[model samples]
Target: MKLYQPGDTSRAICPHCGKLVSTTFAYRDVPFEDGSGVVKGILAAVCDECQNVIAIPAQSTPAIRRARDAAEISLEVSIPAPEVEILDAAAYRVDPSATTRFRKSLFAFYLQRLRHSEETAEMLRRDFEAWNAVKTEQRKRVSRGIRIPHRRLSFKISPKTDRDVQWLMETSGMNKTDTVRSVVMEIEKDLLGPNTPRELRHLQDIAAVVNA
Candidate 1:
């Protein structure tokens, strides 16, 4: 691979100009594709015409990845043992060798996907209402019967994901705890299904890197 340096010139297709154009390598602050965050002062190929960072060198990949990891925030929640197990089961089903880390990745993936649909708020409300009913019955059982166990699950997530969860809360009328559980409920139904989804390939790919 060629190592780029400041003032180095090359010919590359610039998306902004919509054609092949001259580019000059320089260190610049580049935003991630999703616009969630920016990686500062990374070496990139800037289009001569539009002044946009057109192509990044292979060597800058690690620095960009580090910026992403640094921006992560921990997402933690406490839920019943069964719900946690369901999440882990989904992870294992995605990749037989996946560990607990993959479980968090799986749920994070589901949470991110849920925010894309307009109907997610309604679905989450239904799931949470059903869980509320179950909890009410469980309390009655606990009065005369056995105790239920709970566990704490935690993982690192991006700020955008945190924002999405908050948005879901506002739309669905569920608190953070119930919101996460409702996500897990959806994860269980999709991941533990009889037929593997086409998106399973993407999930498996994530699991591979996550559990690596």
Candidate 2:
């Protein structure tokens, strides 16, 4: 999930209470230009419940460069949870070139929604169309593709450490693939013993990572 904007409010029907409620959730949206000169749009999912947000591409816009040196940057923003999901969906459909200008207007719509804003949402959509033309031209210059290999592997979560992807990323500092491979191998050795022969079944979960 991508992050919500700060101070952005949204209205939604509460599932738990079945009441129409409005609240603000905190999140961040940032745009990064990659080495290929391509700018990838990103959204972060900030959970207001615990104030934890994870950074990821807003939709699937690839980040051309590393986190630093991004062309356009925005701070963490807050919005209502339902609106946050709406914004997240919009991000998925947003064109990378117009990310900055479009997102700025989206923030305005977020504010309107908080105050019950249908008019404001309409206004924001108008601005989004206008901004797209300019940004699209700029993004064309830096289009390139970079590939990262993945292996499919799987393993049972150990009863001791439990299965937590975030914990492993934090502790191991290895990319997702390596971490999974290492954990699966360790589990296979422990569960089947070192003498267990290697075969399709033996590598069941582990193979997913390999194929991934």
The numbered model that scores best in TM-score is 1
* Cα RMSD for predicted model 1: 3.4
lDDT accuracy of residue 155 in candidate 1: 77
Model 2 accuracy (lDDT, Cα): 0.36
Per-residue lDDT over 64-105 for candidate 2, one digit per residue giving the tens place of the 0 to 100 score: 334343433322323223323333334333332333234333
TM per prediction: 0.78, 0.19
RMSD (Cα, Å) of model 2 = 25.4
* Alpha-carbon shift of residue 153 in model 1 (angstroms): 1.5
RMSD to native for every prediction? 3.4, 25.4
Q: What is the overall TM-score of model 2 with all chains considered together?
A: 0.19
Q: Score each candidate by Cα lDDT.
A: 0.85, 0.36
